[model samples]
Target: MSMTNRLKVDRRDGKLVMAHFYVAFISLAIGGLAGLLQVLVRSGMFVLPAGIGYYQLLTLHGVVLALVLTTYFIMGFQIAAVSRTSGTLTSKQRKIGWTGFVIMTIGTILAAVMILLNEATVLYTFYAPLQAHSIFYIGLTLVIVGSWLGSAVILLKYRQWRKENHKQTSPLITFMAVVNSIMWIVATIGVAATVLLQLLPWSLGLVETINVGVSRTLFWYFGHPLVYFWLLPAYMAWYVIIPKIIGAKIFSDSLARFSFILFLLFSIPVGFHHQLMEPGIDASWKFIQVVLTFLVIIPSLMTAFSLFATFESYGRSKGAKGLFGWFKKLPWKDARFVVPFIGMVAFIPGGAGGIINASNQMNQVVHNTIWVTGHFHLTVATAVLLTFFGISYWLIPHLTGRTLTKAMNNLAITQGILWAVGMTFMSGAMHAAGLLGAPRRSSFSEYGGASIAAEWIPYQVAQAVGGSILFLSIILMLYIIINLAFFAPKGEQDFPIGEIAETAEKTPKILENWKIWIGITVLLILFAYTIPFIDMFHHAPPGSKGYKLW
Candidate 1:
């Protein structure tokens, strides 16, 4: 191609990209630090003097990192998807998207500051009766509104692409973006409703006392699906980006579609799984949520088997033999491949724990303990974070039109190992501690009075060591990304799969239509949630003496 005819890539430079990544990394780094600190405080290795600092950090770490990092990079990934498939975005769309990011960042910062100043220490859930500063609610509103706008910009451009390529079905990446938009539209409603009706009124003192049970029901109504919101993007990275980099088609595109559909349908009604420990709700209602929870597991298991089968198929194509021997044939040296691969390996055990948590009997034992935190951290922080890390490494070269240095690649691999190893140790310790009845969110425990101080001491110490290794992994990742962004050579490099440009001809549409599934999702959600929600309305105030805890 002539110089003038050569396609130009959209540069991920400018102040916006810089600002987004900077805020994202800082938030995540702080969150990672807080994780270690919590483990330390709980393990009795270090004393945490009672005050607002620990709680505020914990609160800020959970809410900010959960909201900011996930959404910010979902926008970034949208950009990558569009660029790879459609060349570049119009200047107008890019500005709107980044503007939304800026608003979200400021909102996140405001909320963080409020917590740090001890104005909002009610934990991540803005559950009723425990009101925050006006600024905290205001900040949260801004964050939600900003994310909506970001989703709008991405989806608008995606739809425009669809219009031009009438025959083409949405690419899996773009389909995920679409699903994310739809999910958010449904998912944010409960929290938004709670913020407006319950939290805002309570915070402003317009209400003398809010119904805590009703508020919690609504908050978690928005809460559980919010987890799927964090996870869908990670799964998108696995389904779309990984296969592209590894030179394989997705093993079962139909299965991938089912996974997304299942998420849309089941994620909403299962929120009561979090409420198993609380009293007041009818056992029958909780039992319904529990059954739906197990039903939801079918999709997760299907996903696990499908992705594993995808890897097996790839290995077989490369002339590998034996059942699990395909694991060795994977591109282990490539950070993009290895990080997510390791993440999935860790997710298997952690996910099983999640299944256990969904059970009424198992949940009663582990609820409000270190075990809950450990299970989720393993699934969310470790699994989702590793997937995002791999996606960043996988896409950064294309985004910058440069290949990362070999040294950077090696650093990434080493960090992935450390991250996985650290999580295994930490989560394993947490499981034991939870079984021993160690409480979460408490800084210390008196060992002698009804507690085994001697036995608890060693577990706490192991947690600290594990946490230290985790912190080191974060530092290593920061160093590698910084090096890749600044020092790596810039210019075209073959992406192994070929240059990631939109194919010139339109491809045929297969299963991209959304209506049938959306209808099913609506029906499934109603079927799953209708009885429990109705029962909540008919039941007496949850704290009545007749109410009982499981």
Candidate 2:
């Protein structure tokens, strides 16, 4: 094959793969720096000035990673998987794929521009009554447009292959891509509705006002599932890649399928759980959202059990004796193993925090406090970040034909552990401080109470330190990825062992059995949601003067 032909090998092994790894590092660096700035300013650090810098950085840290990195990286992986699993992509589809990348990149730049200017400093939720510049909304829309286009290409190519080869089932990874894309399509609906009907009008001054409560409700519709949108990729890593990395076949493919199903069904209905503290919403609705929060636990536990069992199988196969002995037998040296291992550690504490926040009663204590921030940092910064880093390590070598040094991989593992541990201590301290009534979103001292002031000092300082360590760790990660991507020696490398041999049998008839699952999820969400809204109608909103918007 000519070099150009090889470049278009329709396989996951080429420049496109390397590009994905490099992109992950860049996004992580941007996001991590944003994260550090958030902590430093929130810590009341003397060096950090008060005002726009703090909020701008916080919003950038979030919007950049959550909006740009998550979608872009997921699409890259999805594209690669579709091509490999389908055996090839048509020439037109590859062009669409790159086009999506360009659009997303431009959208991300627009967002960052707005954020740095402090014009889009609404902290990503962009909750109602807090509007950013018009460009922010436009930037966000462009991002959605790009992602949707990518999804179309992936599904279309998959369809083309299935039509050509009538004797095939979509492989597990390909199925995951289709399912997640549908999830995104469903997830984006609320944001799309709100932006078009509410935010866009408000931004353009076409409307003097909009309903705060209603707008908030709409945002959460996308807001919470957005986490799953951020998360499903990490979970995907856990389900498909981790077991293979650890030297075991998937414990149960059916169980893995079910976890994705749970993600689809339960992820959306629970958005109101984020609103537990807000008034004007009925307690009954909050209660239901809380229940769905627990519903999320079922799938999470299934994942934990399945992943652990896979490791157990691998351990036994490698001649290790006894239960839990697999930890020692595992290939700690492999980049794939490192990513999922840290992910597992972060998942335990992060998942627990999620459950706590999901509870209506507990949420009242932690809501709008530093504790809430801590909980998410544990999950997003810790768990999701690890998955991103791990995949880079695994893919970069094959994509770039460069051997990522073992020393650097080990450095990554150590850094990951410190990052997790640091986040835990800081977040735990925040939770304790929150119960002590340290209010969130304040930029002042304890308003003349020394005792309260004294209590906050320690936790704030700890967060700063934790944030600092995490920040440095992110820099190290960037160095590692950059070295591998551009500077490392280039030579052919094989894909990780134990990848499911691509074959006709793995593909499924329906890449996205859209009607059945999507329909069920919509209905379940409606059933779970309507009662809350109905009850709220009879009750009154707190602090609302007949639905004031201005």
Q: Candidate 1: give its CA RMSD in angstroms.
A: 4.3
Tell me the lDDT of model 2 at 7: 25
Candidate 2 residue spans exceeding 4 A from truth: 1-24, 49-52, 165-167, 444-451, 497-512, 529-546
Could you report the Cα RMSD, in angstroms, for every candidate shown?
Answer: 4.3, 3.9
lDDT per residue for candidate 1 within 227-307, as digits (tens), equals: 888788778777766776777666565666667777877788777889988765678777877787777677778778767
lDDT of 2 by residue, 1-550 (tens): 3211122333433445445445655777788876776667656664445555655776777777767677777777767656655556666776676677678777778878888888888887887677899888888887888778888877887677657656655556666777788788888888888777778878999877666666777778888888887787777778777776766787766666778888888888888888887777777777877887788889889988988877777788788887677779988777667765777787788898888888877777788877777777777766887887787775666566677676877877876777776776677767777777676655434333556677677777777787788777777777777777778777654443234423213434342466888889889778866765555444535554225455
Error of 2 at 527 (Å): 3.1
Worst ten in a row by lDDT for model 1: 1-10
Candidate 1 vs. true structure, TM-score: 0.89
TM-score of each: 0.89, 0.89
